[model samples]
Target chain A: MLRVLIFSIFASSAAFAAESGGMPQLDPNSWVPQIFWLIITFGGLYIVISKIVFPRLSESIEQRNDYVSDLVDEAKTLAEQTEKLNNEYKELISNSKKEAQEIITNGRKKLNAEFDKKKNELDKNISELTEKAEKEIQSFKSNSIKDVQTIASQVSGELLKELSLNDEIDQNIIIKKIEDISKKKMGELN
Target chain B: MANPMNQFEVKTIGPKIEIGNFDISFSNASLFMVITVATISLLFIFATKKKSLVPSRLQLLAEMAYEFVAKMISETAGSKARPYFPFILTLFLFVLFCNMIGMIPYSFTVTSHIIVTFALAIFIFIGVTIIGFVKHGFGYLKLFVPSGVPVVLLPIIVVIEVISYLSRPVSLSVRLFANMMAGHTMMKVFGGFVISLGLVGGWLPLGFSVALTGLEILVAFLQAYVFAILTCIYLNDALNLHH
Candidate 1:
């Protein structure tokens, strides 16, 4: 195949170049030192990495992870506390609202009872005053009627004397006569 | 034109040291390896020094690398592979830094060499095998005998499976080494063209070199990812014995 040919050509050229200036890699003399140094260096590196480097890196990484997780846990607890406080605040607000509503209704009921009692008291006082005024007016009318009757009697007697018709005029007779006459007139008018 | 291969050459630095028969002298490769190790160690150490709840940029970088490998292992090999996080992270960071550092002009790529990658890969392969055996005992051999094959084809299938299993290290190491080496070599080759062609005519190769540099950077990250993921996959095979 063309691929094989190309590879052989490349290999031959590499060999020719190798033969021209001996490949240092093929020199057995150098291998000892290279291998020796390689063991020392590689072994030293392995120890350093395994013992020193790995533990340090792992510790730091583990520490970071632990710190981050602790922070997250604290944040979660804090969030829960906030939610609890918010719920408590809402409950307090609702409780105060309910108490305020009860207070307002109780105050209105007390005011209404006082208002009704005062209205009843005012109605009674007004009725008592009107009844007293009516009684006073009735007594004054009776007394005035008595005074008018007496005056009528006196007037009749005087008029009889002045007229010179009858010298013996009895006041009671005159008064009775006047009263009967007036009664008859008043009855007739009624 | 400068030999692009010279960039990979190992040069001794300071006094040479020998232990027994081996020439274990400190070289540029060794220096860079130390750099790679020290770079990761210091960066990570500094990043986590504060251990602040909120990570700084450097800390974020370190965490990202850690999480990246952790996620890769968990996804590929399951949570049972959690213990291997440090090893996989080290491997990934080491390879990634080597490739990235190599991207700088005139710097050496430690992983571009076969022996280095091979060593790492062979180590991983052996470690994974040991884990599989430890975890499953003799039952780990069931990995070579997949399920739902015809009895007649079982022999062929088992042989193929065994070969592929054994080739894991070679393939794993070569894939990273070849990619790094080829990309660097290609960039070097194009860079040579830029100089030989002179100012007016060299713009084309210069543009290609620039583009190839970007691709190589991507390849650098990608190869590291592949190397890590492949290790996770092999670990998965060992841990779970996937059909």
Candidate 2:
């Protein structure tokens, strides 16, 4: 029933359109409605779109732009932080290497100083021992010379007593001469 | 055979009301225009309702359309034309929908009417002229007077420029009204042939009708785009007054 009613309306209007001449759009009778509706529709749309629709759409676009910019800013900050951390890590490694190098050099210097001190002490001790042995030899040589001279004097006196008179003068002289010769020999040996 | 011109006729559709002598009555043109408005409103409302950073397909399409008009106006008229962005968009969509709707079987195209298109054109003409006058005062008359012209040719050139300027609305309105009316009439004529020829003979006319319909749809979009762009150009002249 609805379809029939709709078709009938379409048919009747279609007939009217067919009967019109030249151009039906020019008919003075229709101008009023066209103008009327155009104003209503155009005016309404202009207001709604300008005031409501356009603003909202532009706002959404603006929001998207802001979101993108924010993301870019965050990425840039992250990159900068990464670069800083990388530099810091490198710095730390270099600093530790410098410290280790300093420690090794310092230990070497201390060991060299201790070794030099011990070597110097050993050299001083060796020199002192040699001096003491030389001094002892000098004293022993003097004492042996004295004993030899006394032995020579006693032997000469005993020989003279067994032989004849006048032995004192000759024995004394011989003992003196032997003492001089012993002294000369001891000096040559020293 | 049925008259091809018959499709352009306007008939009252609802209860008719009067204001004194003026006939302000509801008609099919009004009906379709109302539908266009509702469709535009709803489409925009839904398109913006989400307002997601990542737009949906619907939102993207809607944004493209909105930006198309916005960009056209900005490029043509510069920032001075910002005020008329909504008006220009409304005009474009209204003509576009009317043309598309007219393509529907058993539907009326509101833009097919001369008074309708003429009224729109004339309104634009007057508004642009007023803006030109208001912005530049009497200086706008300089638009017709080309610089560095020989004194002998100045008067003649001015007259031609004035005539062309006066003809803007006529040319603008006629371009749209004539295109729609002619295409529809041709389609109707072919459609009549299809019926009269019957079966085997009708096949040829039916094919022509199909081709014509496709052509008409293209013409519809082009005409609307042309109308809106021209309007932006005119607005540019008024706001900027390059000459």
Candidate 3:
């Protein structure tokens, strides 16, 4: 299609130029200056594009990607560290609680043992005092009994002296006196 | 009959300026190039300003253009050349726009001029050369000689490779300029035929014009793609210095 177009254009242009008695205007040589100018312009453009512009744009994109990834990694690391620290704190709290519970149990056991020891010592002291008191009471009772018997015998003797002038008339009365004396002795013993 | 080819004739926009040895004629072609540059800049700026997650129509168009060139560069020059996406994209759009604009009535096609196309080609040539030296230093000369050639055939292979390498700019420039110039000239001739034929007989030329328009549009896109792809190939040589 393009070739046909070119041929038709050339054929028509040539016919028209010849009919007008003018020189052919679209000769190849006429384009020499234009070609040189194109080379100069395109040369400069290509240099700027490849060397400076393209490199800078690519660098910017790479830098941006790196920055984003770095940010994400930093955030992930921080989150992990925080989680680790939290676990450490939880363990510390649990260990301290267990230690506290052990201390309280040990203190209660020591207190109960001391209380039992003091109660046993008090009971032994009380028993010894009771035994000594019982012995003293027994001795006092025997002494009192002996004193009463002696007093009774002395009184009987004095009575007999006073009654000596009338004694031959009543022998039976004497016997009765002896019996009363014995009875008095038994009462004093009781 | 009015000559359609007359539209392409270079007309002076302002007086010619001569500053010492410099002779400058600012023509309609230059004016249109300036317009094209301005239009491209404005369009991109507007399109990308409010970049959305789900793109607006304008942003979609802009992103599509970017993705298109990016894919092309990666495909042709490998992923290493993805960095050159913006430059390649700009070149393709600018050239593509210039060609399409020239197809419009009374519009001057800057790319049709040999000077414009050659300029682009030479820019690629010089740039690739510089990259080769910078990347491989003196070893860049090895690009002209393959590594695995037999000793007897080495010189012949090297000569052929060198000739092929040197002809890159010529072919690149000629391809673009020839395509644009020929397409536009033909369109002009057919347009002239339509005008000369009365309304009763003008339908044939009209139908041809429509078909030609569609084909020209396709050619415009293809030429820009070819130009950019060739640049990538040249860049690859510079970067890798492969035979």
Candidate 4:
């Protein structure tokens, strides 16, 4: 099929050349320069485009896309880190608050215990002082009673010697002496 | 009286240069090819100088041309070959503009010539071949042999594949040259009829000329599209090496 087609083209060219009065029209040589020139031109153009122009364009596009993606990833990472740090800070704050509360509660308990201990010691000291005062009062009363008895006995002996001379005066003297003795004992006890 | 075929004549300028056995002449055809290149370059430069989001008229046209070629390449060759969109777009625009510009009052259609179209086709052929080799190296040769072919028919299939590969350029070139030449020749012949018939009877051929002119315009665009699309297909084969 292809041979037939090629043959017809060459044949047509031949016929055209023949009809044109052997003027060397549509000659193969006429087309040779054009063919060679075309090959050279296209070859040079393709090389320049493939090697230089296309590579530059493609690289620029790829670089732009990569830069954009990198920026997005960086933003995402920063956001995640920020969230993590915020959570950590919140946890620290909550823990500190709980610790502070616990310390305050423990301090109040210690103060209350110390206050109760001081109150118990003051009560015991007051009781011991009152008991000592009672003992001293009892000793003073006993000494006064002995002194009063001796004095009374001396006075009675002198009075009895006088009464022997006056027997009738003894009854009135005894009664007066008894009354004075009772009064002395009551004053000493008070 | 104007001749219809007169437009196609190769007019020599100054003196012909002879190099050894070859006698090469620079004619109106070559001159117009250079003009075509310059015109296309200027058109693109001027149109695309301020490529706006909301395009101006010229920018709109330029963008439309770009979009047309881009879509064609993507649709025909797939997304992997989308990188070649610029080259293919430039080829399409240059060819399209040249063909359309030739339809002007007194202009030469460079694409009508086999040498010009063949140059383009052969360039694509060489480029595709180089790509296949560069990508797959010696393995590129495997493209010629089918995998599922029976042992008995292997020789025949291989021969067919080789022939097909070799004929790619010829088919690619001939398809463009033939279409442009045939359509322009028909337009010229019809134009001759309109001129030969004087004012009273001329209206009939004049009307035919108008319709033929519109048809020629469509053919011009169609030829460019066909040439570019085929180039994409060839490039696909080079890239994928599909059977």
Candidate 5:
């Protein structure tokens, strides 16, 4: 069996080591195999790692780094765009507010001017109508006073005629006297 | 009871194979090396299979390892060491996996062996040296001659510098091998005590073994880190030729 052979080999080697009275590492018989295997295994490892493992790891790491930086760049650009939009929005709002305020002020100024003009026109019309009415009343009062004096003098003449006293008085005198009396009565009333 | 050294003993796993005078038969050490290599390769391959933007845990692990070694190279050796990233990553992962695998009960620790670590360190030393020559020509020899030393002290200083430079591989290899070997051996020794002390007295050694296992795991990671960083430092010296 391989086990027995392995055991025998171990036993023989152990005895040989004992006979040599030294460490097995110092044993010359084992050095060749150890070095040979070391060269083979280390060489193989170096090749596999350099050719395969290292490249893959570095590639993935590089990929992750690139992805992260790209994300950051995208986020930065997006943030910048958002800020630009925000500034535009703010400017638009302020412009509109200014325009609205200007419109309101202009409208108020126009309305105030129109109101002042209309009020002045109405005041002038009212004063002109009042003056016309006052003139008409004054004219009517003077004419009515004249008519009353004429009627009084005519009635007096008729009464005098009926009484046969009008022929004794002068028509001119009667008219003059009525005029004087009316003048005096009017002055007193005034 | 088994000898604690028996765990370190190199044993043939399959039928012996010979090429000329060399007995380069498959061994437990070899098996573990294959396992370490296989595990690392598979884990990474699987981890990066999706390569998704959002990483899974396995992918995160693979990336962390990549980043750790990448940072180590960039920091210690600078950008000039970029070409050597794979080598450093492989070295770090290999030693790390080997140490970690060894922590598992009954698993072989490839890095615990001196020949294995010495092989790696010597390879790095030779490779870095060759890189230095290739990059800087013979001017790389100026590494041994300090710039600030006076003419009289230059000889002594250069000698010291040369000796230190030569000892880089030895120190690098020995540091890792000794830390791993000592930690594993100590754990094994305590483990032996736990078994021999019986149920009533074994709790103490058991506790120590548990604590030691934790420390050994930390040492395993630290040793791997130290090994990789030192290699980076060496690479830096060779590339930059800094005093």
Candidate 6:
């Protein structure tokens, strides 16, 4: 390969530098060239690495870290949002249940109040009618009793007139006797 | 037969250039260093061209190098070394390539030279000391004073600390230079033995050479890692003044 040939050319030329006085590394003469090349090569490498290579590598790493952190932040925000929505839904369900219980209780109370009011009104009317019926019955019984007493007295007097022995009887006594007879007949009929 | 040690000898690759009496001619070490830099540059350029998040093979390698250096810096120096990441990463890659390329048969190890290693270590030392002074002003001198040392031992401890601090460049450069040079020398010695032993007995020393090569490869990587990590630690000490 062309690359290998070029390498060999440089290699052969450099190897030829090994044939002089002592260990070339320790020789005073060789230090100059080594130092010269060192300055050029090392200095150039330093400039290149510091100015260009390192920064790019560091930037790439930073960019990757930033991308990962951004994803984490987004995921955390979405999780928080979901939690908020879930809490709201829970509150809604609980509120609806509370409202339903209140409605049932109100309906039951209203229905019971209406039923009690109608029953009380019917009770008052029934009591009044019963009292009136009792009073009317009492008045009718008193009138009938008085009339029976009077009629009994009159019949008794006519019978006594027809009979000669009744002339000796007192008026008061006759009335009392008629009343007693009517009382006896009332007791037997009751 | 050519002496095995002759491989370590220095020679000029081309026409000599002179600058004010300085003999800075083109040489093997320079060539290898140039090769290392070029390869490193091409690798990064190719690896990063696509910029794909899902990495290709080269991209993965590039990314690994980036992360490896970054992690090492953060671990040893903390995040304050963020700005110095490129410098440290460059040093690691360069030294790593230098060590690895030297493992090739008949190739020069640029890092094997004492002068080169010392130059790098001295650069690191001077830079770190400057940073320490800039950050802490005169307070940087307090690095030698241990916080909890008994008063009796304070003088001795401070002396020790100061010596160690001053010896940073020497220790750093010598450690890397010695490791690489010793490994390569040992391999060469065993290679010589294999040749001298001929086919019948070469197998035993050859096996040793193989094992030593593998070990040397591992050492090459480790030494570079250690070198960079120590640099980071020194940088940390300066940046934070955590002596």
Per-prediction TM-score: 0.81, 0.73, 0.62, 0.57, 0.85, 0.71
DockQ for the candidate 1 complex?
0.43
Error of 3 at A83 (Å): 22
lDDT of 4 by residue, A38-133 (tens): 344345444543454334333443555587899999999999999999999999999999999999999999988888888889888888888888
Candidate 3, after superposition: displacement of residue B168 in Å?
A: 1.1
Residue-wise C-alpha lDDT for candidate 2, range B154-205, written one tens digit per residue:
9999999999999999999999987787677668777988999999799999
Q: What are the Cα lDDT values of the candidates?
A: 0.88, 0.84, 0.72, 0.70, 0.88, 0.83
Give the Cα error of residue B234 in candidate 1, in Å: 2.3
First chain TM-score in every candidate?
0.66, 0.47, 0.49, 0.49, 0.68, 0.45
lDDT at position A87, candidate 2: 100
Give the count of colliding residue pairs in each prediction: 0, 1, 8, 0, 0, 2
Worst 10 residues of 5 chain A by lDDT: A2-11
Clashes of 3: 8
DockQ (C-alpha) of model 5? 0.36
Instruction: Give residue A46's lDDT in candidate 2 (0 to 100).
Output: 84
Candidate 3 chain B weakest lDDT stretch, 10 residues: B17-26
**Each model's DockQ?**
0.43, 0.29, 0.08, 0.04, 0.36, 0.20
What ranking emerges by TM-score with the best candidate at the front? 5, 1, 2, 6, 3, 4
Candidate 6 clashing pairs, residues 3+ apart or interchain = A23-B8, A24-B10
- Model 6, range A27-136, lDDT digits (tens) per residue? 67677777877887899988777776777666666666787899999999999999999999999999999999999999999999998998898998898898898888
Candidate 2: lDDT of B131?
A: 95
Q: Flag regions of model 2 displaced more than 4 Å.
A: A1-20, A79-190
Share of reference contacts found in each model: 0.72, 0.71, 0.14, 0.05, 0.73, 0.52
lDDT digits (tens) for residues A25-119 of candidate 5: 78889999999888889999999999999889889999999999999999999999999999999999999999999999999999999999999
Output the worst ten-in-a-row residue range by lDDT, candidate 2 chain B.
B1-10
Give the docking tier of candidate 5: acceptable
Q: Candidate 6 at A140: error in angstroms? A: 34
TM-score of structure candidate 4: 0.57
- Per-residue error for A98 in candidate 1, Å, reads 2.3
User: Which numbered prediction scores highest in DockQ against the true structure?
Assistant: 1
